[model samples]
Target: MTDFITRFAPSPTGPLHLGHAYSAMLCHDMARTAQGRFLLRMEDTDLQRSKPEWDALIREDLTWLGLHWDAPVLRQSEQISSYDLYLDQLAEHDLLYPCSCSRADIRAALSAPQEGHPHEVYPGTCKARPISDRNQGDALRLHLDRALVMLADDLPSFQETGGTHKGTHQIDPDQAQEQIGDVVLTRKGERMIAYFLASAIDDATQGITHVIRGEDLFDFTAIQVILLTLLNLSVPTYHHHRLIRDENGKRLAKRDDARAISTYRNDGRTPSDIRRMVGL
Candidate 1:
């Protein structure tokens, strides 16, 4: 059996929240129970919005929660060049395209007799257009149509984290192909690369064997799976744990300061209390 490895990756966009606590604790506990190594990775890819103070706070919060890791956390903001190399690799394979469409244009152009994730379906006006012909836009999208055609003959199964299907739930590939089309690989105004690409590369290079995150991100799994295949990297097992929602059944956000881990910490709440609060 492969030695299990997991990581707690948090973006320092804002303070940690109840949802974050639940997810981090789950990763911490699972790695411990399985005798796996749990790593700490700071996802500060969004350079414009990410701050060192918040990064420091994230470290402080997780430690206060009684979670410690090996020295030298994997901070992604320091790894922009690596991301660019991967992009160059994809570009060499003719797998990426530049997208110049704006959000309003996408919404206006979409003729959706279709379903999608939280993001509205892209109209794909520039899907067939070449990158050179497109304007300098804020986001860059993966060429999904080309990607699927390439996978038509060799669609393969990627490993997901154990306990992913502890209940009755099913999803189909046909539905996946239809529902998700070309999505952003790099967004405008984002200093570094986007999450999907950064995540896949980091997980592969860091020797991560199990990728654990929230189930809300479950639908986006296909994008990363394709990334792993395109880059010839091993697909780590994915464990998308449940999220912490409030009475309204909405996932918690860092903006909700009342539930912010800093707020809780300031209120003299212990990490044990956080674990209990989020029912981890």
Candidate 2:
């Protein structure tokens, strides 16, 4: 009764802080308690920001917290070809196209006045735009032709709420069409494969049974779920945990160096102190 699988995937962009410690400890402990397989993966896809030193430190820090993984650590940077193949496959399904919309273009488009609408939705200016139209400054996007179909037709998907998921859901397809509307599935210039693609592919390739991460990313899960279906990859259950916040009730990040593990270590804080500090 224990075929659970979990992964602690940490980006190697910065030193692990209290927030990271909390996520790591929580994920690893839950996996262990279920007698499941726990794995480690370095999300060092951002070549510009990811440092090998930081990756090494995360491994050391998690180990210091008495957590272990079942296999050699997998790194996202090593799986580019795998991602590329999936993008091409989706295009073969006629589900992807090229787009030239920049961030400013998108934000500005959404800001424009529209039929008494209070807020902006991704108006899909490029939805009907032909792909042959020069991809000048544009990036490749996964067309949501089936996004509405999958959701309306009762797409087989599940959400993990801190543990194993249950039952298939008939997602509202309009949400994807409105919120996503063929968002960029692959960009030509970005070193990091967009988060949605990288995560969906990694989870499938790694046999990850559950994806437990911060809830702030819950909105983005729909995109990943959509991608999983597009790529013919298995959708892992998702469990978005509560984030650890600072005294100001703001989310913790590397920007908060004062809460860095190194800073705590320098002040002679022990492993047990970490669990307490982060309220684990």
Candidate 3:
């Protein structure tokens, strides 16, 4: 087998849809074709919404679609301690700060809608505030300005192989501030680890050489790249594929049961049908 390793990670919050199948199949086929390892990860960090049943359903759907993942699926819920360790390292470097801003607070602060991303680009509202003034319910946010300054001379670059955005890209100081602002590292909940934080750590630790995901996440790749650079971890090549959209040209959501793999299976759809639908 080659040294190339890839993963198909899905959150256990809903049924496996066509979009999820496409992503999983793409990752699986890539690894199989290159004689590399394909790993499965369950991103069940949302304690309130994640369910074991959904995890089981995901496995069944993947199996029904004739997909195979490496043994011993990794669950994000089991890696909180590891995430906390990295969080501590960032804190020691003074690149993290407490954020007590509520959703309403953020919405009120940003008068205009955030371009290219769904969530509002954080305005670094609580960055200058003292960490001692942090409340128990407060979440942690990355100080992008301070982080960039810390890595002033040693900023890292990443390679992309997918879509029109393919190339070696460097972190633009101006773009980082304007487009990707101070992102939250932790949230005010049981599972404090944010998606970017956990994903960066997992990709590095698991030795993932290539990251394959939808183009919708293209904008957020910079955030993960920054985190990996700060943590002194290896950055992998990225391949951002096209997303599966609905009739309205909207990306398929988890709640869209009509487009779900389970529904297709019930309607006598074969694995080949799935591959054909997703243009495999």
Best by lDDT: 3
* Deviation in Å, model 2, residue 69 alpha carbon: 1.5
Clashes by residue pair, model 1: 138-188, 160-238, 161-238
RMSD of each: 4.4, 5.2, 3.2
Scanning candidate 3 in windows of ten residues, the lowest lDDT window is 106-115
Candidate 2 ranges with C-alpha deviation above 4 Å: 103-121, 129-137, 150-152, 163-169
What's the C-alpha lDDT at position 50 in model 3? 79
TM-scores of the candidates are 0.86, 0.86, 0.93
Residue 39 deviation, candidate 1, in Å?
1.1
lDDT of 2 by residue, 128-225 (tens): 66556635456666678655564455575566575233344445576666766666655555533666578778889888988888766666677778
**Most TM-score-accurate candidate:** 3
Whole-model lDDT per candidate? 0.73, 0.72, 0.82
Cα lDDT tens digits, model 3, 38-104, are 9999887666677999999999999888888776899988777678888889888888888878855
Using TM-score as the yardstick, the better of models 2 and 3 is 3
